[model samples]
Target: MQWKQNLNHWLHHLPENDPLKIELENYQSDDKLMEDCFYKELEFGTGGMRGIMGPGTNRINLYTVRKAAYGLSQYIKDQGQEAMARGVAISYDTRHLSKEFALEVAKTVGAEGIQVYVFDKYRPTPLLSFAVRHLNTYAGVMITASHNPPEYNGLKMYGEDGAQLPPDAADVIIDYMNEVKTELLIEVAEVKQLEKDRLLTYIGKNEDIAYIHSLDSIKLNDSANNKDLSIVFTALHGTATETVQEAFLAFGFTKVKYVYEQCGPDPNFTTVKSPNPEEADAFTLAIQYGKGNNADIILATDPDADRLGVAVKDEKGEYVLLTGNQIGSIIIHYLLEQKLEAGTLPKNGVVMKTIVTTELARAITGTYGLETMDTLTGFKFIAEKIQEFEQTQDHTFLFGFEESYGFLIDGFVRDKDAVQAAVFIAEAAAYYKAQGKSLFDVLNDLFEEFGYYIEETHSITLEGKDGAEQIERIMESFWSNPPLHIGGIQVVEIEDYMTSIATELPSGMKSPIDLPKANVLKYKLEDDSWICIRPSGTEPKIKFYFGVKGKTAEIARNKLRKLKKLLLQGVHV
Candidate 1:
């Protein structure tokens, strides 16, 4: 009955000729659909909000976009006149309605007399983050759903540091968002007025040049023989093709080829089932191109160009997609070895990875006498560390990555940058090729030196209101009664990030966790295997991440499979 009343409110306020109005009218008779759409307002979390695009309050649309922008605008205004003068930088990806949503954000923020910089056209998420600091803006907004399906679009907010808003800043915006009575009543500035008052400006090539120019410092080797490395790249119909090509050219990588079919932006993602580079199917076209071109490496970036997927030829001459952890291991080893050779390796060097990331990073950094720190599961936490290191001058951030294909090479861009990763991958490939090896070979070498490290992530998708309740039940069940042994391996310690405590088995001794509070749990096994469980902050799913190390690849894989099965048996999907 409440949802019906909410539906009626929308029908009463929306214009008769509006597209959303027509959609609402057609779906009015569908009770289940109506409830799903009007059950509650779309959630704006620490990373901002994402959901299906439609007319209802629960869906992401023009009104919800405006409401989010209004909250951000109010938050900026609270920071005083200088914050208003510094303004916000906005960009979008290749998703449907991305450009429209971005323009709406600019209009809404500008209406509050805050200056705005809008990209002339679509750009990657990292570019948006870079534009925030590059232009000295107070905040930033990216209109994108990253690698979500075509029907989904959302917004992500950033701070002055060019990273996703931390929990404190995001909390203030949520408070402001809840004070708004209705999304339908939000107002925005007209385009003509925004331009006339100089409250809005469009940025393009010049900013891009500066971003690319910054890459020069990330290079560790001269890499004059760039022609030795052949690379095949696909943007997955997203936003990184031109920028990646430009960076490659600037870095002297001329043997790069693009997957023509999936080169440009396509909201429908016509060539792939999903635009997510993490999935193997997303690289189907890229793999074909790589094999045909006899390329040494294949690269793919998601719709936002913030995450990268890599494939390399093995000994059999068949291309196999490398896991995020594997790619990261290769990059770290290359950087550290090259740095050591050049005598530029800092004694205080540091590497950062998420808790769920492979421990191979730690082992690699340890060899060079560098420290490795683990953050919670988001890039924002890693960014937080980078910021801290800057003020304290404690350690130099060499690299940071998550297991889900997101990586950041330098602090110039405070988020995962696929353009930077692509160039580095190319450079790394060339450096190895001159040494009579490939990336795959380098990965195998790392595993041989260190033990074989394998990692996998499994997710259970549960949608709708009932699904939310089920996720809650699952977390409670695990927290109240954790297993003493998983896959027959003894549980040495259990960490509950929600309570910020780690409990050692048997003794029940507890220690404080220094990281920020989050809803997550990690079970450290007697062996070098661990499992992490957490509800996805951006999607309706609970994810399980498993990692294991053994003497060989098969041993590691078997251990991973057993651990995953043991825990999955207890969780009801």
Candidate 2:
């Protein structure tokens, strides 16, 4: 009944001839669909608002975009005239309505007397982060869903540092968003008027040139011969085309080939079932191209170009897709080794990763005498650490990555950067090829040196209000019961991040976890394997992460399968 009231309010406030009004009218007869869209306002999570594109309070549409932009405008204005003068930089992806939503944000913020800088075309999410810092803007916004389905689109806000807004800043914006009583009543200025008033500016070629030039700093072996290393790159119908092309050229990667079918912008992602490079299927075209050309390595970036996936040839001459963990470990080893050889390795170097990522990174960093620290699940938290290192000077930030295909090699861009990763992955490939080895060989060697580390992620999707309730119930169930053994391995430690406490099993000794509180649980077994369960922050899914180590790949895979089966058997929708 309350959903009906909310639906009626939208129908009344929206213009009779508006497209959303007609769409809402058509869906009103479907009770289930209507309730799901009108039951509540779409939440502005720590990363920002994301949802399906539709006509309800819970969907992403013009009015909701206006509401979010207005909230950001109010927050900027509260920071004083200087903040408003600094303005916000905005960019979008290849998704449908992405550019339109970006313009809507510009107009809404401009209406509040705030300046705005918008890209002339859709660009990578990291470039938007670079623009915020490059232009000294007060904030930034990226219109993208990252690697979500075609039906999904969302907006992610960035702080001045170009990282996703931290929790405290996000909370302020969420409070401002809640203060708005009527989304439909939010006013937006005309793009023409904003341009005439000089409140809006379009950024393109110059900014891109600056971004590409910055890649020079991340290149560890520019002098290494790259012509012999052939690479296949696929942008997956996203935004990495121009940047990746220029970057490879700048780095002397002359033998690179592009998967033209998936290079340009396609809102539907017609070339692949999904645009996510993390999925093996997304590399379908790249693999064909790789085999035909006998390429040394293949790389793919998601729609927003913030994450990368790599594939390399194994000793058997078969192409093997490397997991995010493996790619990160190889990069870490190459970076430290090259730096040490050149006598440029910093004494206080540090590598940052998420708690859910593989521990092999720690093993690698430890050997180099570099510190390895764990953050929560988001790259934003790692970005926050980068900012802290700048102020403290106690540690020199070297690299940061998460298990979900995201990586950041340099702090110039506060978010994960596939363009940077692409350059480095290729350089590493070339560097290894000179020694008569493949990227796959390098990964195996690292495993041989640091034990076999395997990681897997499983997700369960549940939609609508009922689905939300079910997720909460599942989290509560795990919190209350605290399993004693998983896969028959004795649990040695139980960490409840939600409670910010870690209890040593059997001993019952408790210690505080000096990290931000989140709804996550981690179980450490006596055998050095670990499992983490947490609700997805950006999607309608709950994810389970499992990691294990062994002397060989076969043993590690078997242990991982057992861990997944036994723990997942206990979780229910």
Candidate 3:
């Protein structure tokens, strides 16, 4: 393969004292490892770039990071002097090399005569979003892999609006990244020089204080005493422990307990196989603490604290982990009900969710007479809608969520916030507790009122360059050979997002989809169940999302399992 040639070239040219050189020497005997490391450059997408940490063009290292930073700097320069002066707000989570990468981006920007504001140390991803708006920076960058494994790390760039870079802006950065031949040869400003020139600033506590105060606005029951609620929270060995604890206490939640074992900044994530809350095992320790302390709820955030996972006591006192959809459903009901009663619900109020999220959100928000809008599957689209609301004044963005546990309760923080969700959900539990109802009970009540709606996501992981190609073929297969039926249900309608059209099966009727075009295909069944297929934007997986509403939970589970099995047939990615 040409990858060997690339490896030999790097080995010959890379400096002897370079840190990545040692990593190359260790793997020199392994051709497969060398191919994977040197085959191709990591592409920065709408969510920015992420990869395994090592030496090579394919890996996330100082050289590749420098290239990304150089592109970002040039992009800022292209935006004009005002944008360069406004600068970029930078932050990192507790992942390894997070601090170094944050500084790397900072120095690159500063070297180009652009200002840079960075956190003193590790902070959650949401705080970075808040900082971008708080500091009035031209853009923002966060160093994290979110919930990826310990060996992986990433860089996510955000625009001035505090959302992930939209398509138009991201294209500009990619264009600049393409022109750089040698990523490691980039220049960076010295830390001392930047500081002396006032081009680099350290953002410490004051911005955090502003964020904490904003969380106060999310409390539905501001006057409701939180004494009755007990919370067990774990940061999963990443960021969010201190900020969450402080915010909880400040909001009058005094009985909060922490899972001490998982609180430290251990980059290996020794406690769990994967530190992702979407998996049941992530909440193992937190649930144990919840049971021991008789806590009302258990909360777990990913490495960056943008995504939240929840576990609540069921009727039999079993700690049942709630899906992202379920938690979002509960939060929506609680927040909107309070806002409605207080006569605070805006006349033009709206709730937003990704197209892949459960329609249960639609039912709940519709009951409140709030308009519901669907964006392509990302929190950035929701944030875009929030920004649009501010300019047009046509609709007030009341709430936004994705089925992946990313939620933005208000526009105060433009990105998904687990710190905000943690405290707010605790308050929600307290509100329900005052009525002698558990969150599970509230969920059951919603099911009874709106029928039992169950949503499940099935993902097929494919890795490296070949896997990316296979994922594309799988998407192409779904597009060309559309299924007639799934799990005994007829495909009544198909929405091909890539084509931006909805087609009715029998009548052959068609209508345009208004949202941004994406590589997603959704089929609505005759029985009201639905299935969506899309390649995950952040990870190397083809995700199939299923949602079914049945008269009973058992029926929904059976239907979901059957459909998942059918979809898995002949698909090996």
Candidate 3 Cα errors over 4 Å, as ranges: none
Ranking by lDDT: 2, 1, 3
Q: Model 3: what TM-score?
A: 0.98
lDDT of 3 by residue, 1-573 (tens): 788887887788789998789889988999888988988888788869999999999899978888898999999999899999999999998988999999999889899999999999799999999999999999999999999999999999999999999988888999999998778678888899999999999998998889998887787777356977888899999999989988987788888888899988989999999999999999888887888899889999998999999999888999999999999999999988999899898989999999889899999988887888999998889999999999999998888999999988978788999998888888888888989998999999999999899999988889988889999999999888998777667899999999899999878899999988899999999988899999988788889999988899998888888887898885765
Q: Write the per-residue lDDT of candidate 1 for residues 1-573, one digit (tens) a residue.
A: 788888999999999998999999998889898899999989888989999999898999999999999999999999999999999999999888899999999999999999999999999999999999999999999999998889999999999999999999999999988998888889899988999999999999998999999999889888686777899999999999999988998989888899999988889999999999889999998988887899999999999999999999999999999999998999899889989999989898899999999999999999998999999998988999999999999899899999999998899999999999989988999998998998889999999999999999999989878888899999999999999987667999999999999999978999999999999999999998999999998889999999999999999989988898899999975
lDDT (Cα) of model 2:
0.93
Model 1 spans > 4 angstroms off: none
- Residue 132 in candidate 3, Cα distance off native in Å: 0.6
Error of 2 at 124 (Å): 0.1
Clashing pairs in 1: none
The alpha-carbon deviation from the true structure for residue 34 of candidate 1, after best TM-score superposition, in angstroms, is: 1.1
Query: Cα miss at 473, model 1 (Å)?
Result: 1.5
TM-score of each model, paired residue for residue: 0.99, 0.99, 0.98
